[model samples]
Target chain A: MKFSTEDLIEGIRSGNKRLIAKAITLVESKKAEHRQQAEELLKEIMPFTGKSIRVGVTGVPGAGKSTFIENFGRLAIANGKKVAVLAIDPSSAINKGSILGDKTRMEELAREENAFIRPSPSSGFLGGVANTTFETMMICEAAGYDYILIETVGVGQSEVLVADITDIFLFLKIIGGGDELQGIKRGIMEMVDIIFINKVEESNLQKAKTTKLELKRALDFIPAKEKGWKVPVLLGSALYNEGLSDVYSTIDEFISLKKKTGSFEGVRVQQAEKRFEYWVQEYILSMMKKNNSVEEAYIQHKKNASAMVFNPSTEAKLFVEKFLSKGPD
Target chain B: MKFSTEDLIEGIRSGNKRLIAKAITLVESKKAEHRQQAEELLKEIMPFTGKSIRVGVTGVPGAGKSTFIENFGRLAIANGKKVAVLAIDPSSAINKGSILGDKTRMEELAREENAFIRPSPSSGFLGGVANTTFETMMICEAAGYDYILIETVGVGQSEVLVADITDIFLFLKIIGGGDELQGIKRGIMEMVDIIFINKVEESNLQKAKTTKLELKRALDFIPAKEKGWKVPVLLGSALYNEGLSDVYSTIDEFISLKKKTGSFEGVRVQQAEKRFEYWVQEYILSMMKKNNSVEEAYIQHKKNASAMVFNPSTEAKLFVEKFLSKGPD
Candidate 1:
């Protein structure tokens, strides 16, 4: 069970499941030593990592996000594609509720030999660019999974982050709007390239149809955020086992279209740039957090602010300038 | 007026229009010396800010965004408030077209002695949270402008950046959602606290009404992103001067509710924290951008990436770590 960077790189290329999972654990580990090893593993496997179709799936708690993903994965498997599932569990930091989102929920996909599901990192930052999640994705892609499905309970910063690393961001809704849509973030609506109105069964069929039209009306107004791709709204009942193919094909159409328009590579570059920017941010903040003077300056400036002697912008600028004055030689 | 920092600060406090414009120019100056003086001027007038009802307005071009803001500003002034308009002309950098958004567009408001209008900084870095905008807002507040109207084209980073500095974020949309909403960013939709469906006069009234209903349906599904308030969709015609009062009152209600819930100050603290974060980010990026070694590392790493020798996560970590290794004396 010992996994080194080469073992990981080889196992992933040859499709070794246990070794792939081990590689993921190393990547998700918080220990500095483990992170070093994980980085090495990822680099060794870099050649194999960009071959898969990476799709990010997100929705609210009861939006049939899990069911739709389950059926979608199974459909992909049936179509001769090996599928790997990864979930970004934001709530794990609070309630450990993400325990319920694992293999138990995607039972069929979990039981399939061609499908591999790794639970969300128990120690992730929950944002879309979780250091470990991004690394884990590289591992999955290198393991020769034909499709990488990243699921997140669309809340907090997940959707925007998901869009950054995902090829096509898919938001699944359970055929209803009313109060259910109340909790949905509009940013999620904007980032999605495809919308699936799931759970359109016997009684909800008409409602789902109407919801589709309404979505189309609103979405039709939204010029394309992504290049050369019209955001499409489709219907499905994951429970009834229907409409999954159309969903799959539409996703296929999106990738091919974006690829043809050069947006596929263009988006990947943008994602890389965003990730680079994020790292610089996190590193600088951490460095300043370690400096006592920055803290003192903030306290002094905030005191001055509360007393009406310093404005917020001035206070912020002063604090930053103080840090820069002491910044690296 | 030949402006000194102290004179500019006093002029702003005493409501001198020329002095206030001078203070804004100093804040917007990229030169280190000017930035220092701007900070001093801002600190001098810090006590006078945080009193006005700061409203951030955004809408796509041709969506009556300018006309809507002009009416909104005038309505506030007519209600016994001194209105100051600071437009975040994002397109100014590219098209140099923000000239039309100045006093010439809002003739009545522009001519009113009580109104102070600053054309969007012709040299502003397109995104709305330009540091100068923050300082300009403070100067306007100190100058006794009871209402601060910040207008931005809804298509860029301006709306979200404006949201960080303003109390209530308003998105102005004309009747139908189709092509008009096309250019609108999804983040703008999510960030807005109130949406005004403008141009609801004569023939466009019905379409506006239906758009309102459709918006309500989607908004109702979205739980309030902020506490103690519901995102309200209002009807308005800035051209006809109808429904402007409702929009104003709804904004008033939002501020009052947020105040009662203590989220008003809570949001301010969050804004301050985000600004601090952004400043640190900009400082680090700038420092690295100036370093030949970092640039060389990036090019080499990127080359390795294109050759499949480094995954993005690995590449980013290596670059950040290189910077961190060289950070702090």
Candidate 2:
């Protein structure tokens, strides 16, 4: 289970899947020594990280996410692109194997030599899961994956974070109960660069067409993510191997357009800035957690706040004052 | 202009409008001494706070939000309730005097003996505006206002923060461009306790009715804020002086139902807890801003990140390590 730093760096750069997985697991480790090693490994692999086409996939459960990714990954491989699929389920910790935890979830994709599939980290905290996912993504990129599909279920804040780290965001929708965009949050809609209406079988083709029109109309009101680029809502069935090529071509078109406009590179830098901001918050929170007096003050303040002894803002101000006066470790 | 703490407290408690305004201005001041005075004033007025029906109102531009608030406040006064209307336009700092800045926007309500209207504080940051709004709300409560309406233009993060500080969140939507929920964000829809489709004139009555039904169906998919509460979408014309009483009665019913279920008090405490969390972040951010080494490191890391020298997470980790080792002020 233990590997030298140079081994991880070499294995990652040489596209060794086993060592890549190990590096990801190592970064996910909470051990202080492992964290130091992980940081060093990441720095060594920095040159290889930004070459992949990063795509984010999100949809409600039963929306055929696994199937779509499998078909899409296969299509990319057919087009001579190495694919890596990573899932980020913030609920994975509590739900305990509800989502991509099982390799069988993406069985076909998992069996592909050119494809890499990893489950959610089960970190319990969104930030922890996100950090590991980012690390895992960089490791995959170093391992020569030309395409990365970062998948997250449609729930809570995970999708938003996934969108932040990806070059393009894809949303999958299933027509059910006649309520189009029911589970989709408006913010997610705004973030989406492409949408796929999955499972458009012969029986539901009409319904799919209707939903697509409605979705397009709804999208017209929402601003496009980039100038001169329209978010296309494509209909396809991953199960039937239908419209997969269209989906693949659309993604390629989006990337080409973004690159042509020069917004593509700008976005990546901004994403890095956002990631840095998240780390700043994470570090501050970690420091607060380590301080005993801060912990005591937080507890006392919460109790007094419940009893309305003082305003919560006042208690917070007092807590911060005490914390700053104590100095950092 | 300069009064003792006792004078301010007595003025707030005795419902002296001038003194209440002065106390709020003091809290809005960024001066260190003024902050200390504001803390003292807030703590002294703690007992008198949390007695009013705290309501938050939000709508897109031209959603007739001011007209609705004016009518709603008048209705509350007709029911023998003292009303306070405060606007929280986060954009006010940049778009000087765009919304609720001029007293004439709610001229009728402003002239009411029992109604007090305050324009949005043109503090640039959303947090600064929200903090000042919270303080002003508490001051209004101490001034014996039985009903407080916090108005924020539906933009950015202001609506979410406003929802956190208030007991009930009401969303005002205007039927426009044939898009029922064109500008309304989904997260806002979820947080909304009640929705009013404003501008239902005779010509647009049918359109409003259709929009209301469509909105009701949309709300069905989103879970209610409270366990037993169904978020109602009501149709009303704020300009025509119609359905204002219905809106008032619905709000009263909601409060009573929540009170009977005992969730009302619990929500207020949770809101206080949320406000405390915000203050914690604000203080940490302020501390980071005050630290010079942290600033220098951030700039350097940003440059390196843009040049693709290292992963952003790695840079952020280095920055955090440096910041903590520097020790706090």
Candidate 2 lDDT by residue in tens digits, A108-206: 888889999887785543223444787789899999999999888766788887977899999998999857755566467778899999999889899
For each prediction in turn, the share of the native Cα contacts (below 8 Å between chains A and B) that it retains comes to: 0.45, 0.51
Q: Which pairs, if any, clash in model 2? A: none
Query: What would the TM-scores of all predictions be?
Result: 0.85, 0.89
lDDT of 1 at B280: 41
- Measured against the true two-chain complex, the DockQ scores of the candidates, in the order shown, are 0.40, 0.42
* Candidate 1 lDDT over residue span B294-318, tens digit each: 7678667655544446776567678
What are the TM values for chain B, all candidates? 0.85, 0.90
- Ten-residue segment with the worst summed lDDT in candidate 1 chain A? A123-132
Which stretches in model 2 have alpha-carbon errors above 4 Å? Answer: A125-130, A175-191, A203-231, A260-263, A299-308, B125-131, B174-191, B203-235, B260-263, B296-309
Interface RMSD of 2: 3.7
Q: How accurate is candidate 1 locally (lDDT)?
A: 0.73
